[model samples]
Target: MYLTQGLHRSLQRHPDKPALRHVGDGDVRTHTFAELLRDTGQHAAALQARGVKAGDRVALLAPNHDRLVRALLACWWLGAVACPLNVRWSAPELAYAVSDSEASLLVVDEALAGLVRELPLPVIDFEQLAQEAQGLQALPDVRAGGDTLAAILYTGGTTGRSKGVMLSHANFWTASMTRGAELNNAPDSVSLLVAPLFHVAGLGRLVGQTLVGGTCVTMAHFKPAAVLEAIERHGISDVVVVPTMLQSLLDDPGFAPERVRSLNRIAFGAAPMPPDLLERALQAWPHAEFFQAYGLTETAGAVCINLPDNHRDPAALAQGRLNSVGRAGLGAEIQIVDESGRELPAGQVGQIIVRGPMVTRGYWRLPEASAEALRGGWLHTGDAGRMDAQGYLYIVDRLKDMIISGGENIYCAEVESVLRTHPLVSQAAVIGRPDPHWGEVVHAVLVLADGATAEQLPLPVLRDWCHERLAGYKCPRGLSHVPALPLSAAGKVLKTVLRQQLAA
Candidate 1:
C-alpha cells in the first residue's frame, strides 16, 4: 500500500520501458523504468549521506523536472516525507512553509536558488544532487507502513495562508488506484504532465500513471503551443488540465483536431470548465474522451469524476448532468450535510463532505483546523453543492464565495455560468462588493473577447443579460472589465486576489 510499491512493480514488470520523459526549454530527456529505479536508489543514498534519515522532512522548491520526480520517489524510498513548495510563492511564504514543516534540507531548482539563499536550512541544487548521485550505490530497501506520512502538500491558500495537508502512503496509493481504475489507465498510456507538480492534482496524476506503468511526459511549465507540440510529437494519449489551461489550448492558434488526434482522454478539474469552452473542446478533439474530477488537496486527488460518457451525451448536457462533478469514485463516500452536520436530502444544497482512505489524516501541526475540517469523521469540503437522486454532485460554489445580498444568498458560479454563455465574454468572475443597503452586492469582473471593448458590455447590458437568466438579486449590480483574471498555480480563478483588488 506504499506509494513506491507500484514503482517496484513497474521495475520488475517493465524494466526497459520508458517511464519518464522530461521536456524543458527545447531539451528532451527520457529515463527508462530501470533508469528511474536506479536514479531513485541513488537519490535515496544521497539523501541518507546528507543526514536525511527516515521520518525526516525534505522540502522541494523546483519546477517540473525528472529530478524533482526522482527526489520525491527517493524520499518515499527512504521513509522520509517530501514537502513540495509552490514555486509561485514569495520568499516569506516559502519561509513559513519550510519553518512550519521543520524541513532539515531544501532541494531547489537552480532557477529558484536565489530565493532560498537567506533560509537557514542546508540547500542542495537539484541538478547538482543528480550529478553527485550518478555513481552512488543503491540504498537498502526501507519500506514504510501504509499509514506512514509520504508527503505534506500545502493547500492553495484561497482563504488564508497555506496549511500543510499531511497525506500518508495509503492516502496517495488509494487515490492513485481508484483514479487508475476509473480512468482505465493502462501500461501503454502516454500521459502529458502539464500541471505543476507542487499541486496535488499534478502529483496525483504522476502517481496514478506510475501505478499502472504508464509513460509520463513532463513539461517544465505549461505553454499552449508547447503542449500542442508535445501532444503531436509524442502522440500523448492522456492529459489532465484545469479549465484555464483548457481555454488557452482552445484559443492557441496551433491547436487543431489533427494536433491532438492521438489523445484518448482529457481529464479536467481544479475548477469548472465554462460550458462554451467545454463545448468547443469537445468539438475540436472529437476523438478524445472528457472527464471532470472533483477533490481538494486534503483528499490527495480526485474522489469523484464526471465520466466521458456523460460528457459526450447530448441528453446529459441538456439535463444539466454534464455540469455535475459525477458520483463518488471507487471507495469514496460522499454526502451533503447541513451546518449542524446532519446529512441533507438529495436536491438540497449544503456542505459537501467525503470519507475515504484517500482523504488526508489532517493538516500538519494545526490541531484546531484539522478537527474543524475533519469533523464527524468526514472531510468537510467548504463547498456548496447538491446531490441528485441518481448521485450526481453539482457544485454550486464555494460556501465562502456565496454573496449575501439583502437576505438573499446568491451563488457566484450561477451568475458566472450565465455570463460565459454570452459570445462577447471571454471570461467572467463574480464577487461580492460592500453595499450600504444590501450589506453586500454582486459584482462581476469580465474579460472581453478579442476586438471587443468594455463599451460592448456596459453595466446595463450585462445586467439585462443576467436578468434573463437569473433572479434580480442574483444579477450583478456592478460590472468591470479586466484583461485577465488572477489565477492560482492550478489555473483556478483567485477570488481572494479579486476581493483584495475590489477592496482597494
Candidate 2:
C-alpha cells in the first residue's frame, strides 16, 4: 500500500484524464495525469540535484494551488518527507517549524519568497522549482513505501507550543482511502480546493482526489461569491469545507439550490458547527449529502465520519443522536474513558481516545509529550465526548474549556448556548478569565447585532439575560463586545489570541 501507488497506476490507466485545474494570476490552468507525472518526475530530479535525498524533509509554505500538489507528489516520488507549513503563520512561526523539522530545502510560492529567505534552509520558489525539476531524469527509487514518513504536520499548540505530528505513508493512504469509500467517491468527481493545502484536512483531500484519478479545482482563497461562481461554472461535484466556510456559503444571498444542483456531496469537519446553521444548510441544499467527520492533525485527518444514512434520518436525532459524529472509520478504534484510563459505559461523558493506523507515530522528538499524549496504546484526544448504546458519538466541550468557579464546575458552552439564543448576538466566544478570588471567572466576548453598542448594552443586562437561562455561577462576570474575533484562515476562533488579550 504505497502512498503514491494510485497516482502511479492512474498514469498508466488514464494518462490523459483531467488531473488538476487551478485558477491563479487572472488565468485558469489544467493538467492531465500524464502532465502531472512528467512534472513530478522533473521536480523530484531537481530536488535530488539540490541535495534532497531519501529521508530529508522538504518544507512547503504556500496556499492551495497546482504547484503545492505537484510538490507533494514530487516529495513522495523522491522518498523525501514533505513538511507543509501553514501559510497564514507569521515569519517567526514559520522559522520555528522549519528549524524544528530540520528541513534541508524550503519551497515557497513567489508570494512568500520574503518569508522563506529569513529561514536558514535552501529556499526554492515552488513554481520555478517544479518547472526546473521537470527537465531532470525520473529515478526508479523515488516511490515511497508505506512506512516512510510522508509529512510532519504541526498542530496548533493550545496547551503549550506546537508539536509536529509525524505521518507515515500508510497513515495518509488510509485516510484518503477511507474518505473516498465513505463518500462513495467516483472518478468523475470534481472536488473543490478552497482551504489552504497546509492543513491536513485540505491537503489530505488534495492527495485523495489525485489518487482516485478525480479532478481538483484549486481556489487560492475561499470567497463566498467565488466559491458559488466556481460551483456554477465548473459543475463542482464535491467540496470539503469547515463549519465556518459552510456557514458563509449558506448565508450568501445568491445561494440558489439550483446553482449548486450538481454538488452531490459536501464534507464538513475541522471545527464544530452551530446545529441551527447546519440544519439550515441541509434545508438549502437538500440534494447534497452532508457528512460531518471528526478528526485532528494527530489522526492524519478524519477518524470518524457521520454517514449519509445518519444525516438523512432526523428520527435518529430525536433518539438522542442529534447529528452525532458517527462510529469510527476503518482501521480505527474509539473509546470513552475516565482519568484512570478505565473504559466508561455507553452514554457516559469522558475523554475521547482513539487508536488507529492513521494516528501519528508520535509528536516529533518530544518523547515526554509524546508519552503523555499516547498513553495506554490510545491517542488521548483531549476532547470530551460520549457514545450512545448504538455507538453514535456526541461531542461535549473541551476539558480545559470546563470552568471551575467558587467550588462549582461550569461548562462555558452551556453559558454560550444561552447567550446565542438571544437574537441580538451575532457571535459569541466564551473563555475562562483569571480571577483573584475564584481562581477563574467566565468571560464572554460578543459581536452584537445591528444597532447595538458595548457601552449601551452593559454587562449587568447581559448578565441578567444569561441568568434567566443558566445558574448564577455560570453567568459571565465580564462581557466585552468586539467588532470581530480573531479567526484563523480556516474559520476557527483563535482562542489563544482571545485568552491573551483578556489576560492583558
Which candidate tops TM-score? 1
**Candidate 1 wrong stretches, greater than 4 Å:** none
Task: Compute the lDDT of residue 60 as modeled in candidate 1.
Answer: 99
lDDT of 1 by residue, 180-276 (tens): 7777787899999889988999999988887778899999889999999999999899898998898998999988888789987999988868888
lDDT agreement with native, every candidate: 0.90, 0.83
Candidate 1, pairs of clashing residues? none
| Cα lDDT for residue 89, candidate 1 | 90
TM-score of each: 0.98, 0.95
Name the candidate that leads on lDDT: 1
- Candidate 2's C-alpha runs over 4 A off are 450-452, 455-457
For model 2, name the residue pairs that clash: 42-133, 42-134, 77-142
Q: How badly does each model clash, as a count of residue pairs?
A: 0, 3
Q: Residues 1-504, candidate 2, lDDT per residue (tens digit)?
A: 666776777888899988889875577889998888888778888888999999999999888888888888889889999998887888888899999999999989898888767677689897779677765787664567787898898877556677999999888888877676666678889999987777888878887887788899998898887889889988899988987788778778888889999998988876666666677888888888888888888888888888876776868656645458888887889999999999999988899999988888898879988999998789999888889888788777778777778877776656776777676876788888889899888999898877877776688988989888888888989988888878787677777788998878
**lDDT for model 2, on a 0 to 1 scale?**
0.83
Q: Please give the distance, in angstroms, between residue 39's alpha carbon in candidate 2 and its true position after superposition.
A: 1.1
